[model samples]
Target: MGETRREMKQSESLQASLPEDIALKIASFLPVGDLCALGSCSRFWREFCGSDVLWESLTRQRWPSLNFSTESSSVDHGDSSSLEGWRDLYVKWHAKMPEAMLVVQHVNQCAVSGSLDIRDFLKAIKHLNSMGLGFKDVEMFLLRPEVNVLLNLVGLHYCVHCLKVPAEHVMEALRNSKISQREVCVKWWNLGRLLFNGFGMRDESHCRLVSLQDLALPQDNQVLAVIHRGQFTRSFASRYPYSILLVLPGLSRSSQVCD
Candidate 1:
C-alpha cells in the first residue's frame, strides 16, 4: 500500500507540473479510452479532459460521418455547449452501429433468398429490439443506403411480387415494424402498385387486402369478397384509391394518398 501510494503521488506530481494548456493539447491526441482513464486522476483532470474540443476531436475520429453541428440540432441532444453533447452522441451512435449492421446483413440475406419470409424478418426485429436500440436508432438504420437498398429489394419491390411470398409475410412486417400504422399501410400500397402497374401483374388482391388491414381500424371482412378476384373497374379503383383512408378521419389529405 505504501509503494502504491508513492507511485500514485509521483504520477500526480508529474501530471500537475504540466501546464493546463499543454495538458489539454496533449489530451486531444489521446484516444477516447485513454482520455476517460486520465479523467479519473482528479477533478481538475476530469474537467480538463471533458473539454468540448477534446471530445469533438474524439467524436469525429470515431465517427467520421457525423456532422455534429447540423445533425445534433435536428435531434433533442441536450447540452451542445459542453463535452456532454459529443460524448453522449458518440456513445449512442457507437452502441447502435453493430446492431444496425446486423440488421443490414439479415436483410441482405433475405434479398439473396429472393423471398420475403415473415418468420425470419420478425426474428430480426426481435433481435434488434433486444439490443436496446430505440425507434430513433431504427429510423437512422433505415436511412443508411446499404441497409435501405437491401430492405427495398427484399421487403417491397421484388419480394412483394415474388411467388415465394404470401400476404401473411407482408402483414407480419406491418405488425412488427414499430412505426406508424399509416406508414406501413402506405408501404404496402406502394409495393402493390409497383408490382401490378410497373411489372405487369394481373393480381393485387392479396397485397391490397393486407394493406387495408394494416390501417388497424375495424373493416368489413365482407369487403374481401367484393375484391377477392380484384374485379373493381378502373374508374372505381382510381376514385377510391384506398378504401382504408376513408376510415381514418384525422389524417391530412396528403397523407391519405399513396403517392
Candidate 2:
C-alpha cells in the first residue's frame, strides 16, 4: 500500500509539472461537462481550465449562432474576479428563453426601421425584466452598440409616447409617477379618426406606431440631446441617426408634439 501511494503521488506530481501551455491545450478539447469536471483535479489544472483561451474555444463550439464579436461583455468586475469571457457568455446562453430571443429579434428589427411601436417595446421590456437583470446590469450592458440601440428605442418610446416628460427625465419621472397614472399612460391606446371609428380591438395589432422623429418633442435636437443624456454614450449619439434615424421622423407634424 505504501509503495502504491508513493507511485500515485509521483504520477500526480509529473502531471502537475507538465508545461502549462501543453496542459491547457489538452484541456481545450475537452467536452464541456468533462472540462468542468477537470476542475476537481489539482489547483493548477483547475486554474488552467478556467482560462479565457479554453472558455473562448468552448463558447465557439457551443453557440455558433451568437455574434461572438458583440456577445462578449467583460465578466471581470475589479479584483472580485469572474469567469472567463466565454464562460460568462455560456452562462447567459443557457439562461435565455425562446420568447426572449423572439422579442429581442423584434427589437432589432424595430431599431433598424426606426418604427418602434409602444406595445412591442413594452413586450420587450417585460421579457427583459423577466430575465431578472438589475437596472445597473441593464445600464452596463447598454454600452454594447446592439444592446444600446435596442434599449434606446425602448427608452425613447417611454420618453415620447408613454410619458409627457422629456427623454432625459423619463426614468426619473417614471419612478415618481403614481402607479395608477402609469397604468393609464402605459396602456395601449386605440386612437381613432373619431368616435365613429368604432370601439377598436385592443390587441397587439392595434398598438400605435411612432418613429423617433415623430416623438422628438420641442425640437429634434433637444430630443436627441435628452436621449443622449438619459443613458446613451456620446459615441452612440453620433452613430444613432445613421443607424436609428431618431432625428428624422419623415413627419410634417409640429416639433412641439407631446404625449
Candidate 3:
C-alpha cells in the first residue's frame, strides 16, 4: 500500500513537472516497443502515448509513400466504429512490414542470381495492390533508390537478356513504373549491340511498351534516328511518328517520312 502510494506520488510529480508538449516530444523519440511499455504505466501516459498525431507522424516517417489521412481523420473525428486509430494502423502496418520486406528480398535474390522469376515479381506487385496502393503509389514506392536499382537490374535480365519472362508480365510491371523506365531503356539500349550480334529481334513485343523518349536525353536526336534505322522496324517507326518527328532534325509531320 505504501509503495503504491509512493509510485503514484512520483508519477504525479513527473506529470506536473513536464508539460504535455514536452512529454510528447520526448515520447515521440521512443522506439515503438518503449512507447507501448510507457503507455502501460498509467491512464494519462497511455492516452498521451497513444495520441493519433504522434502515431501518424511515426507511421508516415516509417512509410513515407503510404497515405493514412482517411484513417487518421476518422479516428480524430471519433469514428472508431469504422476505422482504427493511427496507433492501431501503425501496429498493423508494422506487423505486415516483414512480409513486404520478404517480397523485396525475393526480388533481390532473383536479381542477384541473374534469373528473375516473373511469379515473384508479380507477387510483389500483388502485395502492393493488396495494400490498396494505386499505380502512382506503386511507382513512387518503386522509385526509392534502393528499390529502383533492384527493379532495373531484374527488368534488364528478365526483359532483355534472359527473355524468359512474358511481354505481358513486363508490361504489367512497367505500367507501375515511370521514372524507372529511363534506366531500363538505357540498359536495353546499351545491350543493343549484343542483341544485334546474334540474338536479333526474336520478339518485338518484348519492347513494344517501352517509351522511346526514355531511351535518351530529351534533346538527343540520335536515339530517334537509331530507332528509325535499327531493328525497331517500319511498324515501330509508324507507331511513334510524333515522337520521331519531334526529335529527328529533318523530319516534319507533313513530310510522310515515317510512313
Candidate 4:
C-alpha cells in the first residue's frame, strides 16, 4: 500500500508538469552560445530558441555590426564559411523568427595592420555593432576610431580584459574616443601594438571609467597625453611612456588606471 501511494504521488507530479513559461525564463538568461548548444540538446530547446525575446536579446547583444540587414553587405568579414557558420548557428537557435546581434566578434586584428581609413574604421564599428552574442568570450580587432565608438556604445562599464594596439594608433584612438563616456581603463595593450591614426579627442564621457589593469603601453607622446590627462602620478606615468593617457582632471594623482 505504501509503494502504491508513492507511485501515485510520482504519477501526480508527472501529470502536473513544469510550466513552459518558467523553462523559457531560465533559457533566456543563458548566453547565446549556450543557447545555441542547448538548442541541439533536444527538440525542446529548439522551440525555446524560436522565441522573439531571445532574438531581440541577441540583436541587442551584437548591435551596430549586425544591426541591420542592408549594412551587412559592407562587412569585410573573412571566410564566407565562417559567416555561414555563425548564421547557421543563429538559425539553429533563432532562425524561426530572425533577429540580429548588436556586435560582431572575432574580427582579426591582423586585418587592420596597415591602413586606418574612415571607411575601414566605420566598417569595423559596424562589425562590432553586429555582435549578437555576449562579449565575455569573443576577442575583437578594433581600429582606434572603432575602439572609441566601441567604448561609447558598449559603455565604459563593460568588462574587458585586454586593450591591445600600436603606440601611434593609441594616440589617435584616444584623441577621437572622447565623445560620450569617461573613466579610462586598458588592460594588456602590448608595447608594439598599434592604433588607428586619425583619432580626435573623445567625448567627455570617457572620464568616468578609470584605469586598466595589466596595461602594456608603448613609450611615446601618446602615452604622455593619456598620462597627463589621466593625471597618472609621476610613478605610474613613468612606467608607460608611449601609450595614450586620457585626461580626467578630477581624479586624484594617487588613483590608478589598473586598479
Candidate 5:
C-alpha cells in the first residue's frame, strides 16, 4: 500500500515536470486576456509566452482579420474629447498587449499606407517602446507639402519608410533593431501620384537618409490590403511573394497613422 502511494506521488511529480509543449498546448486554448493566468502557473509558461515568436504567433491567431483606418479630423472622426478616448483605448490595449498577444496581433503583418499624423504616431511609438515590439518594415510615404511634414516625418525612424518615426526613439532603442539580424526583401507601398523628395535629405534638419535599399513595390492587392489594414497573417513567407500598390501616408500625416 505504501508502495502504491509512492508511485502515485512520482506520477504527479513527473506530470509537473513535463516538457514545455504540453504546457504551451494548454496555454494555446486560453484567451489573450487570460494568458497571464496561464503564465502564472509556472516559470516555464511565463518564459514561453513572453517570447516574440510565441506572442507574435498568438497575435496572428487571435485577430485573424483586421482593418486599419483613421478619422480625418475632430469633426469628421468625432469630438476633441474623443482624442482622450483614443488615448485611453490605446493605453489599455498597449497594456494588455504585454500581458498577452493583443498588441503584436494588432500591429504586425501590416503594410501601412496613406497619411499618418504625428501626434498619434508618437503615441504608437510610446506603445511599441513600452512593449518592446518592432515592425517587419515600414515606408514613410510623403503625401503633403507642408513644413510640418518634415517634423511629422521625423518619426520615420526604425523601419523602411523615410518619414516621421523618431530617430531619438530609434537611437534609444538601438538594440531594438532586431530586423537587422535577419534579411528582409525590399519593400515599397503605393507611391503613385505622390512626389516624395526627402531621399536627398542630408541637411541639418534630416539626420537619416530617406533612400530605400531594396525597395520593391507590392504587386498583389491582398498583401497590400494586409499592409493597408495593419493586420498580420500566420504566413510570413519569403521571396517577397507580394508586390503591391496602395495609398498610404507620409510622416506628416501622423494623426492618421497613430489614431
Candidate 6:
C-alpha cells in the first residue's frame, strides 16, 4: 500500500512539472474571461497569465486597427519585469465599448423619432471618432435601412455619396453645418426631374416606406415626391417630373406619386 501511495505521488508531481512553454501554450488557448479567472488560482498563474505576450495577443485580436506599442525608452535597460501595459489597455478599451454602444443606440433612437438634434448627432460622431473607429468600422450598424433613410433626410448619404470624405472633413462639415437638409432634398428633386425623373432608392430587398406626415416634417417643408414599392415602368417614370422611385422585385405594379 505504501509503494502504491508513493507511485501516485510521483505521477502527480510529473503532471505538475510540465515545461513552461507547454503550459503557456495551453493557457494561451483559454478565452480572456477564463484566463483572468484562472489567474486567481495562485501567484505563479497570476503572473504567467498577466504576461505581456498573452495580453498583447488579446489586445491585438480585440482591436486590430488600434496601434499600440508597449516599448518605452524610459524603462531601465536591464529591469525585466512582466509587462502588463497591454492588459491594462485592453481592460480600459473594453470598458469604453459599452458607453460607445449606448451613445450610438441613443442616436439611432433619436433618428427614428425624427428628433435627431444635429449637434447631438455630431457629438456622437465625434465621440466615436475619438475612440479610433472610422465610419467603415461601424458602417454595418450605421447603414441599416432605417438608419440610412434618416441619414438621407439629414443630407449625409454615407454609403453612396460620403465614402471618399476623410473622417476629419466629415466632422468639420458636421460642425459647420455645411450640408443643409433642405438643400439636399431639393438637389434630389432636381436630379429626378432632369436625369431620370426618379430619385434612386437603395438596392435593398425590403424597405418600409415612410410618409412626410409619419416623418413629422415641418409644415413648411414641401415634399416633391412620395414613392411606393412596385415595378418601375416608363409611363410611371414620365408621369411625374420628379419622383422617388423604389424598384422592388416580386411586388405589385401599384405605385403612388405625391406631387
Question: What's the true lDDT of residue 253 in model 6?
Answer: 27
Q: lDDT order of candidates, best first?
A: 3, 2, 1, 6, 4, 5
Give the 10-residue window scoring lowest on summed lDDT in candidate 4. 155-164
Q: TM-score: which candidate is best?
A: 3
What ranges in model 6 sit over 4 Å off? 1-16, 70-83, 112-129, 133-190, 193-259
Candidate 5's TM-score reads: 0.22
Worst 10 residues of 5 by lDDT: 205-214
Deviation of model 3 at 2, angstroms: 1.8
lDDT score for residue 243 of model 2: 28
Name the runs in model 2 displaced over 4 angstroms.
1-5, 68-73, 76-78, 81-84, 97-259
**Cα lDDT of model 5 by residue, 1-259, tens digit:** 9999898777657756978787677766765568767666555566665543445455433322222134212212345555433223333434544432332232222333322322333344444445433332221111112212221122233232322233344332222432211111213333234338645433121011122111212232232233334332211232322322122333332233222
By TM-score, the better pick of 1 and 4 is: 1
Candidate 2 residue 117 Cα shift, in angstroms, is: 25
Instruction: List model 3 lDDT by residue over 77-141, tens digit each.
Output: 45547556788887777666445455567666654533333345445555554564322233334
What tens-digit string does per-residue lDDT give for candidate 2 at 58-140? Answer: 76654443466744654653534654466777666546533445555777776564434444556665555555333223323
Each prediction's Cα lDDT score? 0.47, 0.48, 0.49, 0.39, 0.34, 0.46
Q: Candidate 2, residue 122: CA error in Å?
A: 22
TM-score of 2: 0.34
- Give the TM-score ranking, best first: 3, 6, 1, 2, 4, 5
Alpha-carbon deviation at 132 in model 4, angstroms: 10
Number of backbone collisions per candidate, in order?
0, 0, 0, 73, 36, 0
What are the runs in model 4 whose C-alpha is more than 4 Å off?
1-16, 64-211, 214-259
Give the per-residue lDDT digits (tens) of candidate 1, residues 1-259: 9999999888878878889899898888787779899888777698788776676667665454345677555433364454345566667667766666676787566535333344444455555545544323433564223343324322332222222234455445445554323322221222234454467544443233133333322243333332222333121134433222111324343533334
Best prediction by lDDT: 3
lDDT by residue (1-259, candidate 4, tens digit) is 9999898777556634757788678778887679878777556667666665675556545442234454334333465543332344344434422222232232123222211222222443444334332232222322223443333323221222122234344333334544323333322222232448755443222222333211213432342244323332221243443222344446553445434
The TM-score measured for candidate 1 stands at 0.36
The lDDT of model 1 is 0.47
Distance from true position, residue 202, model 2, in Å?
38
